[model samples]
Target chain A: MKRGLITALAIAKKDLQTELRTKESINASASFALVILVLFSFAFDLGREELYAIAGGLLWLVFSFAGALIVNRSFARELPNDCLDVLIASPAPAWSIFLGKSVAAFFLLFIVELISLPVFGLFYNIHWTQNFPGLLLVMALATWGITVVGTAFSAVTVNIRLRELMLPVLLYPILIPLLIGAMGTTTALLQGEPMSGEAIASLRLLIGFDVIYTSLALYMIEFILIV
Target chain B: MREKAIYLLAILAALVMIPNLKTVFMDLPDEAMQGAIYRIIFIHVPAAINAQIFFTVSLITSILFLVKKNFVWDSISVSCIEVGTMLVLVNLVTGSIWGRNQWGIWWAWDLRMTSQLMCFLLYLGYLLVRPAIAEPTQRATLSAFVAIFAYADIPLVLMAIRLPNVRTQHPGPVLETGTMAKEFHAPFGLGVLAVFLICTALILIRQHQETAQREIDSLRRELHSI
Candidate 1:
């Protein structure tokens, strides 16, 4: 188990190093998120109260779409020149590879979310700082939720035809419950409410979703990687 | 024998169905609240039940295919999904029509309707993903995985309807309640039985066609090699 964790960390480090050099996934996701925030402002001309009401959904919508850009590449990046094949051939177990990709994706997406938040605050004129801790917790859980499912599905769709298109079609429906949980909690947190009954319910749903899907992805990743 | 069974099932479905339709249209009075629109329940509820059952069957067959690595199970799984997807589409359309008449709107984002929509999209993804992979084993394996993953949503849908907080415009199990009169019970039960029979027949027919299509494709591949 210790060695497996090391292998997973090593794989994640390699991915992060590659990403650092190119800045491809981070740059694309962060800018895309910002563009979406700007676009939402343009699309809706609501006042402060309305903005506060929808801010949670709009924020996560940006994250979900932008994060898709990152996670879609999680395995697809290994496709060129048979890198994925080589990785499978290596001593690292499939779960490690799956975990590694998910870990890397979680960090990348969290960073993107973090960047988007302040800009979102500025544009929407809402102070997220009051509920900063709760908001951060919601963001982490939601981001991890997305990363787990997204990374698993990235592996699923990487080899299929029109893979870029197929990933979202396959991933979003699965992500809906998690998104609802995230949105509910975030919406509550943004409104200066902390740990309300509804928020607690959403948190339970989110945490349950994460546990169920993460274990599923780990158990199933070998089958996905083998052939 | 297989062909005979298909015919028998189809005939049985029609026998139950024709009488049930008559009971629905002729014998039963219009519902007290929903009036004539309530008649759509005869088809809508049955279709929803059949779709859920077929999708469950597909999930089981999918797991079977993965564990056994049998193309036959794969064929059965795909057949069930295709039929299930069609049935779910019917459920959605009929439900929408009922909603339009009863609720003064064609759609609602209430937990039940939203989850039903999500369920439809999830299975539709299963059907859509199958064609994108060319290798037989790979396609079977991937789609089976998808089927298993998508099946998780089924429980969520069930939970959504029962969640106390989330509002649902969709009715509860009317059969268990007094909303549906005792007279509607026999026809409704018959409707469910008929739809199940029809769904089974459709799945068998689709599996047969899929097997034939695979044979033809393999033969063509062999000819090209020659």
Candidate 2:
């Protein structure tokens, strides 16, 4: 078990190293989020009331797409050169590989959020946060939910001829509950309300989603990656 | 014997539907609120129930395929999903028509309707993603994984659809309310029976075709090797 954790962390380190050296997926997804935020700001121009109303969904829309973009690219390097076969043949088990890659992708998405959230606040001119820790907790859980499933599908569809089209079709339906949970949580936090029952329920739902999909993805990614 | 059973089911379903239609059109009294036009329930409700049940069948078969790795179960899953998809579409169109005429709108954010719509879209997702992967086992495994989630999502979809803000046009389960409204019970029960039988028959037929197709493909490969 200790060895497995090391193997997983090693895999994550490897992915982070590759991203640091290449900056390919992170660059593209971060830029994509920025462009979307800018474009949406122009078109939507939802002043304080409207922006707050939809801020959660709007933020998630950009994040989900950006996260999908990053997830799609997570396996790009491994897929093209028969590198994934080599990686699978290595000592790491499938779940460890799934874990490492998802962890890396989760951080990548958080970085994207780090960049995008401020821009969102700027464009929408909204700021209210009584629950910083609570909000971060929700964000982390939601991003984990996104990355686990997204990374699994990213590996699943990595080499397919359909390329990018398969991701949204497969990802969005599964992500609905996660999105709902995030939206509810965000709405509650942004409203400056105390941690109400609905907010706690949403947070709990996010945690449940994180548990369910992440575990399922860990179990299933082996089947997907062995080719 | 299996084929004969399906034929019998199809015939029995036909027998039930024929009289049930009369019970709906002529025998059952008009609803107190919605009147005779509301008789559409005799058709729409059964289709909706079958849609859900058929997807549940797909879910069970999908799990069976994963556990046993049997092509037969996979075939059944495919067939049930197809029949479920068709039934869901039937439900949507009929409900939309009913809603438009009766509720003054063709669509509303009503919880059941939204969830039902989500259910239909989920089925479409299953059908759409099948062709993306070329290898058979991979496709089967991937689809099986998706099928599990698709089935699991039904309740969540319904839950998400149930917004506090939106009241539903769709009525609650008849049995849930403790009474089946006397004369309406026979037709309603028969309609559900007929629809369930038809759904089962369709699944049987489609599964047979899928099995045959698999056999033919294997034979073609054998002949080529020879």
Candidate 3:
């Protein structure tokens, strides 16, 4: 078990090191997210009240697209370098590989969210200091759930033709619950409304989703990678 | 075969139930608001139950395929999903038509409708992913994975709709259990069983055809190599 943990961390560290050197994916995705947010603000050119009201939905929309971009690139990166074959053939267990990759993707998404929050706040004139922690919590948990399923399906789509288009088509429908839950909680927090029982329930639902999908992904990763 | 007989019986059952369905339709209580237009429940309720039946069968078959690694179970899973998708589409169309007369609008993003639509999309995604892969083994493996994942998402989809903030005109859980429960019991129960048998027969026939096709293709490939 300890060996498995060490192997998992090694794989995760390798992905991080590679990203650190390249920086292409992180830079491209963040820039894309910023551009979308800018365009949306201009498009909606609403008064302050309306802008604040719609801020949560817009922020999540940017992050959702950004998250998709990051996941797509990460999965694609494995193919060009033949890195996936190495992972598949390694002595390490398959779940470890799934865990390591999911964690790494989660970290990348977290960084994107960090940059996005302030940009979103500045554009919409919404205060972040009060809700930042809760927002971050929801974002982290929700990103984990999305990435777990996203990573598995990303691997599946990678082998198909027109993989880039196939990934979102296959993914977004399955991820609707996570999207709705995250959007709801974020919207409530941004609006400065007290978290109702329903909001809390949504957060719990997201947590449950993360646990179930991650575990299922871990168990099924071997079948996916082998076939 | 016994399966064939079962299927014939299923057809007979469906035919027999049609007259009973008409009788129930005519006897339904007039709603205070919609008057007799509420009679759309005859078709809508049966379609909705059958859709659920198909989905549940698909889920079970998926689990069996995963555990047994049998291609037959996987084929059944695929067939059931197809049937389920059809049933869901019918339910949605009929429900919308019913909504029009009752609510004065053609459609509403009611909780039940939204959840059912999401369910339909999930299965549609499942169907799309199946044929995209070229190799038989790869298709089965990937689709099995998708089947499991999609089934897991159903509860979450249902919960998202059940949340309070999401507004919809569909009656809530209580209405399903309290008001419409007794009225729906007999037909729904019979319809569910009839639909289950029919779906099983269709899936078995489809599975046999797939297996036969695979055999013929292999034979042709061998002849070519020789």
Docking quality tier of candidate 3? Answer: medium
In model 3, state the lDDT of residue A70: 77
Error of 3 at B224 (Å): 6.7
Q: List where candidate 1 sits over 4 angstroms from the true fold.
A: B157-164, B172-179
lDDT for each residue of candidate 2 in B108-222, tens digit (9 for 90 to 100): 8777677777787777888888777665677777777778777777766655544234566766654246566777778888888999999899889888998897788778888
All candidates: TM-score of chain A:
0.98, 0.95, 0.94
The TM-scores, one per candidate, come to: 0.96, 0.93, 0.91
* DockQ of predictions, in order shown: 0.53, 0.51, 0.64
**TM-score head-to-head 1 vs 2, winner:** 1
TM-score, model 3 to reference: 0.91
What's the residue-level lDDT of B196 in candidate 3?
58
Pick by TM-score: 2 or 3, better one? 2
- Candidate 1 true-interface contact recovery: 0.32
lDDT tens readout by residue for model 3, B19-123: 556656665567666677666666676777777877887788877877788888777778778878888898899888888876778778777888888888888
lDDT, candidate 3, equals: 0.78
Q: How many Å off is the CA of B39 in candidate 2?
A: 1.5
Error of 1 at B196 (Å): 0.6
